[model samples]
Target: MNIKQYLDSTYLKTAFQTGISETENEIVVKNAIKEAIDEGFKLIMIRSEYVALAREMILQANSNLNVGTVIDFPEGKSSLETKVKEANEAIANGADDLDFVCNYEAFKNGDTELVKQEVLVATQIGLANNKTVKWIIEVAALSDKEIIQLSSLIKNIVISNFKEEDYASVFVKSSTGFYKTDDNSPNGVTIPAIIMMLENASPLPVKAAGGVKSYEEAIEMIRLGVKRIGTSSAKAIANGGNIPNQY
Candidate 1:
């Protein structure tokens, strides 16, 4: 319930065997993931196709790391129908959590309704199968005005679609690290920006990704109101960044 419960202090530390683009030769990445699992990094996020394999990998490591994957990924430009299918397939393949991108075009067109509907569909589908649906807002891609709009719309959607008894959780995440240019925090996911979102996002946990590469950075995010951090470095933070030759 406290802030630290949501911090992803060690992200890259979990990048041992990434299925995102096929780490056919980088055995170190795979080894790191296994080591991270054994080291007790319980929440692990992998690509859609890698979820089942990662799940099996987790088992082989003899660890209980929860598995999660992204939908629509970095762009959030996928059609609603496509996103729905991605969510279905990911969940069916054994994903415990889903980070979906925002429909920027929908928001730009002032289609708040459409945006909410997209989230609602995902929320509904994920709920039916007992999965968690977290919407990735890509804070860096939007303006201040757009961010506020997203907050208001997200707030409305949470109440309208997810009933308390339904047992589903909706979240607004910042960054997906899929941007072609940079792989760092927010691009604009700064402390102030995230703080603003988290303060207003009542009942919704904010997952901050990108630009979070250190314990101080991760802790800063928590202090700024982020409830969870979508980091891949689980072991580094737990080790004070002293892992021998850790990438």
Candidate 2:
């Protein structure tokens, strides 16, 4: 089934989050990049600070692995200008995919205009640069209705402003793999959430991120029609092993 091609090998932890020194955390990121190269995964998703390093490694290895970085990661409350600047910097640093954390907070607060503007501007920047773009909706923070609404919103915006051929390049990704919940519930993609996204964001593909651990689960997501599965345990999943307690 070549599940490796459907995986976006991800490592987005910061030094502070890992309670390690910057040098130590970088070592982790470097190993993840090298592992992605060796495993022939579809892409490597990392923090913005490591985009340049990832680019250098992938280029030196002559690997076809695409480099993806998050914009306003984990939090979607950043201003439109800030998101644009971050995305541009990632592109200049050689990121092939820009996974933007959409301003769902604003959308929830009845500020649809701001959300729409950011989606338009960010998608425009990415499409203009010939880069693939994905909007992270942080499904853990939203209800089913919100998921459908937001997914439809992104789909509608892309359909309205962009051409038909470009729709596939803009994805409605599920999570940032960093959201926290009150009951310590699953803070990433879930079956119900992914179903909602796929049902509502059709023609605009879906990328399931966060909480996808085992090869079986990844296969299930793919079976449910997600174009990509983002996970930290890419190697384990690719090899039919499981990494317990990994996000």
Off by over 4 Å in 1: 1-29, 165-168, 180-188, 242-247
The window of 10 residues in a row where model 2 has the poorest summed lDDT is 238-247
Candidate number of the best TM-score: 2
Q: What is the C-alpha lDDT profile of model 2 across 151-236, one tens digit per residue?
A: 99999999999999999899999998888899999999899999999999999999999989899999999999999999999999
TM-score of each: 0.82, 0.98
lDDT values, one for every candidate = 0.68, 0.94
Model 1: per-residue Cα lDDT over 14-43, one tens digit each: 243354443552354455456656665546
Residue 198 of candidate 2: its Cα lDDT? 97
Q: How many pairs collide in each candidate, listed in order? A: 15, 0
